[model samples]
Structure formats: C-alpha cells, structure tokens
Target: MPSSDAPSIRPRRLRSTPAMRRLVAETRLHPAELVLPLFVREGIDAPRELQAMPGVRQHTVDSLRRISAEAAAAGLGGVMLFGVPAVRDARGSGIDDPDGILNVATRAVQQEVGDALVVQTDLCLDEFTDHGHCGVLAGDGSVDNDATLERYRSAAVAQADAGAAMLGLSGMMDGQVAAVRDALDAAGHADTAILAYAAKYASAFYGPFREAVDSQLTGDRRSYQQDPANRREGLREAELDLAEGADVLMVKPAMSYLDVLADVAATSPVPVWAYQVSGEAAMIEAASANGWIDREAAIHESLISIRRAGADAILSYFALEVAERLR
Candidate 1:
C-alpha cells in the first residue's frame, strides 16, 4: 500500500516479528504487578465457587490461608480481601469486630505469607451492612456521607489491627481517605497504607460482583458511585484523594475506564492502580467456555492493555493464573 511518494520510514519493521515486538515493547506485565482479589465467608467449611464468576470462589478461613500462600509462592504483588459476614446490621458492626471475616482473613493471610505479599482489605461497609449500602442512611434514606466516614475510620483501624498492610477505601464518601488515614495514624498504624478507589463508577459491569459478595442492595449505587459520563470528575476525585494523603489511587472497572486510569496515572503523585472487576473476568471466562475466544491470549491482552493504560498495579481474579503463566 505504499505510495510512490512514500518516505523511507517503515513503521511495521519494529513489529514484524515476535523478537522485534518484544524488543520494542513499551509496556510489560509481570507477576509482581498483579494483585489477587479474594472473598472469605463465615460458616463455610469448603470453598464455594461463585457461579457468576466461574473459577473464582468464596473461601473459608483455612482455604483462604492456602490461597494466600499460593499467591505468595506464585509471586503475586498482593491480595485484597472482601468479607462475607454471617450477619449484617445497620451499623456494619462486623466490619469493626476483630473477629470479623475480613479481619480474620487479613490476619491469616498476613501470617501465612508474611512479607512475601502485601495484604489489603476492603475498608467499606457494603459487604457488611444489611442494606448493602456503603454507609448508613440519612433521615430521608439517602447515603449519609459523613456518617460513612466515621464507620470507615473504625473499619480502617480494625483492618490495620488485623495486619492489613493496606486498606482499600472503596466507599466513595467525601473525606473518607482523610478519615481513615487519620484513624490509622492515631491508632499507631502509621505504616498502614491506603488505596483510595478514587474513580469508581457505578457501572452495569458489577453484576457478577454482586453475586460473588452476596450484596443485598435493593437499589442502584448511583448515589455514591461516580457517573460513567464524567471524565474530568474522575480526575477531581483523584486529586482530592491525593490531597487527603492517599498512598495509591485506583480506577475501577479498568477496561471500561482506561482513559480515566491514564489521566489519573499521569497526574497522581503516588502509585495508580486499576481493578479488572468481576464482570470483566466473568465475560472472558464465559466466552472462553463457549470457545468464542482463546482464554489465555485474551487474558494476556486484556491485562497488557490495562498496564499500557498506566496502571502501576492490577487487582484481578486472574492474578494467580496469569502469574503462573508469566513465570
């Protein structure tokens, strides 16, 4: 397709072969850049597979320990824990309970892997509140942002006490990062870091996650989660989190928000993370099961694209599997 007036430049030369492609690669995905997101539940003796998220399980305490060990041995960068409590309440008291599922899992994983992997826990109430909202309701039943910050503060301390190296503030309440950070520092957990879910959008892509976590929401999360239509708003959220002393900023539903992720990555002072949420993982798994796509190649390309989008780290369900392949 070259024209008679074409210059000497041949762009394809650098991509002509696998070796050349490797040599010119601008982005790389290493096992150490992947963080596995895990779910732990109370009163379960064996790991139960999440039907919506094939190949992903809600683990029991002992099983979670084994999985954490596997993550460390496989060289994953970290594990993010989400708890499934046996009971839920308006205040999400379980989140502050030292023996809560998430806290217990955090301690177990920290003990199991030691410094081999960074242990993180979801510092949110959605998974613990009976209403499945991130925070308590106001008098009129809307999300009470300030009240949520208080809960997050206590939750941060609990997670840190249970040995979480980092707490993921996913609630999206204003001032949450500052609340939790101040709480951690005052509780003598100065080394405990915070990963603010700065650009989390309320997307349809979280359908599978609702199943995985047994979320009890009767309505949508549009009240708190960012609207998908806002790009600059995402950047504003990141700026606010950074100002609040967040150690890392994260963009949720990575594939759909790569632009936001890239923007945050370019502007943020700390590490930027992206989450390949449950629906993304389930889509790949479902398509591969039907022979519609090459499973391994698709996952590699998806993750590579996220990394190329400027994620310093990725939290995904495929972390362990992809890590083994990378090794």
Candidate 2:
C-alpha cells in the first residue's frame, strides 16, 4: 500500500495499447447484435428522406429490398419495418390487409434476404389510424384498450402471413401480447415470435419517429405508454408481458431508461431488448453535424454504453451505419 514508486502500480498500463484496451474492454459490440428500424411508405416510388431525422428515409418496396439485402450482408440481426400508409382510418384496415404496404414490404424483404436476416414489423396502429392513436378511439376520443387488442390480433396474423419473423407489439394496449400470441398460434404461425414493448415510456423521444412515419398524432401516448417517472411500474409491465408469453421484452429510448433495461434484464426469462428511438438518434446526428462531436466515435460509445447496461440486442436508426463500421 505504501509503494508510491512501484512501476506496476500504474493504472494507465492497461490503457497503453490498443490490444490491451481490447483485452480489458468490458463490452463488445457486434453487427449481429444490432437491429435496424426502417420505414416503408405506401404509394411512394422513391425513397424520401425524413427531414427531422437526417440520413433516415421512408423507403419504397424496391428500396426496402435493397436495404434488407445490405443488412443481411452486414450481418445485422434484423430489420424492424414501420409502414406509412397513404390512408388512415378509425379501424386501421391497412394494418390487417394482406396487400398492405407493410405486409408487402415484409414479404419482399423476406424474399430478398431469404432467411438471412430476421424480418420484423411494428404491429401498432398509430401509423394507420386517422386519429394517430395506437388503438381505436372511443366516443370520448380516448384509446380503447380492449378494442385495440382485437385489432392487434388481426395485425399479428397479417404480419405473420406476410413472412415477418417477429411481430413487434409497441402499442402498449392491455393484453396485447397474449392476444397477438394466441392469434399467431391459432393461425398456425407458431414460428412467429412477439417482441413486446413492455416498458415503453411516454417520453418526448418519439418526436422524430412520428416524423419518420408521417404520423399525425393529435395527442400524446401518456394514457398507455409507461410514465417516465415510474421505475417499479416498468418491472410490473415486464412481468405482465412475460406472463402473457412475450418472446422478447423491450425498453424504448434505451439511453434514458437504462435503469429499466437493467431491471428487465435481471429477471427476464427471455431476451431483453432496447430501442434507441428516433429522437435519441436525431440528437446525436444534429450535434455531430454541428461539429460538436465525432459522429462515429460518439455513436459507438453510445451503443457500447447501452450494451454495457444490459440490452441483449438494440433496435436503432444507426444500425446500418454501426454495422458497416463494425464490419
């Protein structure tokens, strides 16, 4: 303890070399641990860049195929597809239509990638509903939780039929996981898995996602999505999803909710995933574009920190870029 002059007492020794740094690194990021979240717009023949999120775009079916191919080639774990339909309705018919843009895009990507990458689709109605709610609205203009469960059941079946490997139920409606799972099994899509957004918080972080999806949300998702101030509630949500047979439980806006991520990871019987949502991505992009940070370095560090926190896989807008860099 008194060896002030000891050469071996220096803590900087391990940081002196790249190989040493690599050896001592506590967390490692791989392309296969990344899942890209993509948007496909109906009736759009061209890829349109999302203004709020720089470098992100809503793709056509053709563009989605190309992107899926690239994701597979880069060894990314999967691509989560969000549909931007040209029309919206109270019932969100587009979500259950076999020929709907998202379902079609899912099929196209599945054909293109050929089981090389997991094809996932967001099973939420917000992008397809005129009211911009994740579920049907009642007479009082409030989201109908029970009615939304039924819609989710149809959407789950439609997504599974469209060749989706996983259906992401991000709607936060009560009984959504169980309903979707039962629907999938009844439709003989026993292979299709459900990824539950178990601890999705009603945070401001979804602003860029709305822009990307061309959403017309009239009000906030506070009534359904978890309150940001509650941590124990997150665990309870995860527990409910688990009991309902969710294959994977996810936390949205990973960086701000690492505590919830850790809590879910600790006791989760299945894989625990995190979504590094649109606003989080935009903040990094905006800051980096302003020359405030090294884009690649900051992106890497952010993802590494998330991984270190406890996510088994991360869904990110930066997925492709990070995958390419990792490669």
Candidate 3:
C-alpha cells in the first residue's frame, strides 16, 4: 500500500489523541508554578470587586487571609500582595510604618500560611502615595531615584520585619535591587529574597492596574519605565538586575514582552518570573463575556504561552482558578 510519492514521516500521530499529546508535550503547566497577585484595601470592611476586572477584587484583610488559604490549598506557589491604604501622603509614609496596612497584612498572611507558600510584598509606593508615583518626587516634580532608594531601604526592612519572604522591587528605580538587598542584609534579614521587576515597560496595558490601585497619577511613567520600542533595553535591564543581586528577575506584562522575557530567561542564573497584568486579563474576560472565545481554553492557552516563553513562575489574576482546574 506504500506510494512512491507519499512522505515517510508524519507528525500527526503524536497529536492524534489527548493522552498521546500529553505524554509528549514539551511544556506543562503546574499549579505550583503560578503565583496569585492579591490586593488588600485598608478601609474596606468587605471585599470590593474591580469593575474593569470582573472576577478580581480589592479584598479586606480578613478576606485576603481566606483567599490566601484557598490559594495554598489549591497548591499555588505563592501570593504577591499589594496594599491600598486608607490615606496617602507625599512620601508614602505608610510603607515603612510597622502598623501600616501592608505590613499588617504581611504579618497576617505569614501567621495564616506560615511556610505553606511564599508570601511576597510589592515594594512600591504607588498605592501608599497620594501622587500615585512609584517613588517620592523631587523639588522639580520628577521621581527622585536616590531619595526613593532611602524610602525603599526602610520599607524593605519593614516588610522583612513583618515576615515577608520576598520583596518585589517593582519601582523601576536605578540600583533598586542593590539598595533593597543591602537594607535587607543589614537589618538581619539576609535570608529574605528579592524579586526584581527588571524589564518593566511603559505600556497601555497598565490601565486596568491603575484602576485596581486607585491611581491618582496625572502623567505617565515613561521617564522611569522602559520605552516599549526598545527591545534591547529589556535585556540590558535584566543584566543590570542580575548584577545587582536580584534573586529573581521578572518581565512585566508577560504576553506583550515575551520576547524580552525569553531573552532574560535564556541568560538568567536565577528563576525568572512574569506578570500577566490586569489589562491582559481584562481583555480576555471581556472577550469571553461577549462569547467571542472559550474562556477556559483561552486562559489555558495564555498561561501556557507565558510558561513556554521561559518564565519559571507567573503572577496571574487567574492563578487560583487555573491552579484549581489543573488539580
């Protein structure tokens, strides 16, 4: 039955069945590779759902603990926490305060979860600053890099003191990893890890995130965040972070900057993570709501895309749901 013109090799046999495909799949997604990014607002007695992000919410401290436990039970790797303070000021004084919402939340989560999973804190002042900038401003109204480092140093110690296992240095400040690393080491927190947002870009996909944090910013962060046009700059930033002692390097807006993520991951000596930002999730949710796509399939595909692009871990709004499904 052999034909002279027929091809001898075919690839379809491997993909002909679900079990066959699963057996030979090159990339696999596991619940332990996902990290849930959670928000906690100080004044809310109840969790407040984010409109732009339908399924996500700004949770109360009590609610945060509940969901965090659920995440751990679901076998998710970790949870990254961001705080929305009841009141904000120019310097974001709340960031370093022992009784501040973020610090308090860190303590609560550590007590609740213990070592079940990593408890990470977002080490940025945007949620605590009235101006909604990642760092404090100079007299000229621009973010002051060195001055912000001073703030981050104290904040790093405070987060460490509160029992945060990792501090996500997401401010995009120069030498931020080194500064925070030094502070953490000096404060008897040498064991604490740092997750550096090494290649964060100024992108339109941050809109939903601004709403999530109740940002009061009037202008853009282009001056600090990497320009979207510069592909090489992303790799450069990753190198800088690695040199500065970052324990983990992250590329933000995972889908959009997958090339950058791959570049960083290819060379990084440590674990590389990626964030599936709010806008990315909102787009998928909106499309699914309109019945334009299969929601579950899309979520699975999107996450697999990120993992295939070389992220060791992913921070996603869908982490818990996806993790549950994987289980």
Candidate 4:
C-alpha cells in the first residue's frame, strides 16, 4: 500500500510534458487520415459561401478543380464531392447523367489531381431530387428502396466513368453496397471501390448539410436512416455492408455516435470512417465565433476524440485546415 504522500501509480509523470504526452498518445491524427467533403454547384459562376456552415462553400466547376488540386498538394487523404444541380426532377435523372454536375466535377478534379488524390463522389440522389428524398418516391409517397437501387446502379456507372476512385453510397438505401458494387463491376469499373454509409442515422445534426446541399426535403428521413438510439443496428449495418463488398464503412454524425463508430471499428476488417457532419462542425465554429472556445484547440480536440473512438479516417469540412496544422 502507498502512503498518502505518494500515489500507487502516478499517471501524472507522463502528463508532465507535452512531448511525453505525445509519445504516449494512443491515437494520433494525421493529414492522411482526413478527407474533405466539398460541394459544387452547376450555375454558380463563383464559389458561394454556405450561410449555415460558415467557412464551407458551394464551388463552381473551376473552383472545385482548383481547390481539389490544392487539397491534393496539401497531402490530405482525399476529397468527397457533392453536386448541386441547376435543375431537379422526380427521378433525380442528373445523378446518372454523364454530363451531370457531380460527374463533370469528378472528371475535372480527376484531370487536375487524378493520381495525387483519391477522388470520390456522393452516390446519393437527395441533392438532385426535387422531392428531397434519397430515393425514388412511390405513388403513396414512400421512398422506394428497390427503385432507388436501380438509380444507384446507374449513378455508380456514371461516377466511375467520371474517374471517381470510389463511390460514397450515402443514400442509406438497403443493399446499396451490393447493388453499387455489382453495378461498378459489371460496367467494367471493377477496380472502382465503394464507401458504404452503413450506420447513417436520422439525426437532427444534418441541418447545415440540408442548407449546404440545398436539400428540398420538407419531411424527415426517418424512414430510411437508422434510429440514433440503436447501437446494435449500427454494427449490423456495418456487417451487411462488409458482406456486400464495401471497401470502407462510414458512420455519419460522428460526435453523437462515437460508441457506434467504435463498435463498428472494432469488428470491421476494412477501414472504418466517420463524418464530422455539418451540424457538428457548425456548432464548433459557431461557438468559436462567439469566443466561447479556442477555435484551433476545439477542432483538434474534436478530431482527436473521433480518432480515439477508432476511426481510420475522418470526413470533415475542416479537413484542409486541420491537415495543414497537422503537417
């Protein structure tokens, strides 16, 4: 037994210095472990800043190419692209259109930094659908999962043809991973990969994203997205995606779902990633803007927390800025 003057095991010795703390850190965030999510719009002549998400913007095709190149040169892992089209229809036809905004942006970025960065595109229809749903709506106003899978198959081919290194299936449609994977393979894009948004939840945290993507959704996405209360379901979703040929698995709204992220990461044979969703990022920025928290430190802490939760990669709006700091 130790006396009152000395502790049995004093952990403070290692915490005495920053260098010692760094040396013993179990989770280290690196530039390569960050992926930036960007938005590109069709008719915007110049990049327009998103009001809800302070520093993020809706980029033009030209701006996307330039920024993507910059991100590549910054030595970040990759960039995920979401397109805002000039028009939307019931079927979200733009998603599978070869000349659609997303495909066009993907091609442009591939040309600008093809081998330098892993170019990925959002494999979802919400931004392209006038109905503001992730899938095609049936006569009764329900999102048709099977019908949406067909559209995803078409979108997969279009994205792969546009030089996307990987397709991020964020639509939360069931069997999306298998459908997109088979679609890519059959379309002669066998080398292309799929990043399944396996544990996406219908969280209120997507508020800023709705604004960022110009989402037309008037109703909630509770029908397709997972319930936030279910931890077991997250693991089940991850397992399904794994069996369906997903190259990577992702959990959205990372901060609120660290437990799900950790559980998924624990069993995933492939890389497990998490999105520091728009709301999460916006909250930090908003608080920092009010001088409530140290901006840099908060961002670093949030990222490290996500990393400590077992994410192999973090999809963040601040990826570029944070990666620059990490470098």
Best by TM-score: 3
lDDT of each residue in 125-223, candidate 3, tens digit only = 988999999999999999999999999999999999999999999999999999999999998999999999999999899899887888889898999
TM-score of each candidate structure, all chains considered together = 0.97, 0.97, 0.99, 0.98
What is the C-alpha lDDT profile of model 2 across 1-327, one tens digit per residue?
767676767789889999999999989999999999999999977999889999999999999999889999999999999999999899899999998999999989989995798999999999999889999989998999998899999999999998999999999998999999999999999999999999999999889888888887887889999899999999999999999999999998799999999999999989999999889889999999999999989889899988998999999989998899877
Q: List the residue pairs that clash in candidate 1.
A: none
lDDT of each: 0.93, 0.92, 0.94, 0.93
Residue 289 deviation, candidate 3, in Å?
A: 0.4
Worst 10 residues of 2 by lDDT: 1-10
Q: Each candidate: RMSD to true structure? A: 1.6, 1.6, 0.8, 1.5
Per-residue error for 94 in candidate 3, Å, reads: 0.8
Worst 10 residues of 1 by lDDT: 106-115
Whose TM-score is higher: candidate 1's or candidate 4's? 4
Task: Put down candidate 1 lDDT per residue, 19-91, tens digits, no spaces.
Answer: 9999999999998999999999998899999899999999999999999999999999999999999999988
TM-score computed on alpha carbons, candidate 1? 0.97
Give the range of the ten consecutive residues with the poorest summed lDDT in model 4: 1-10
Total clashing pairs for each candidate = 0, 0, 0, 0
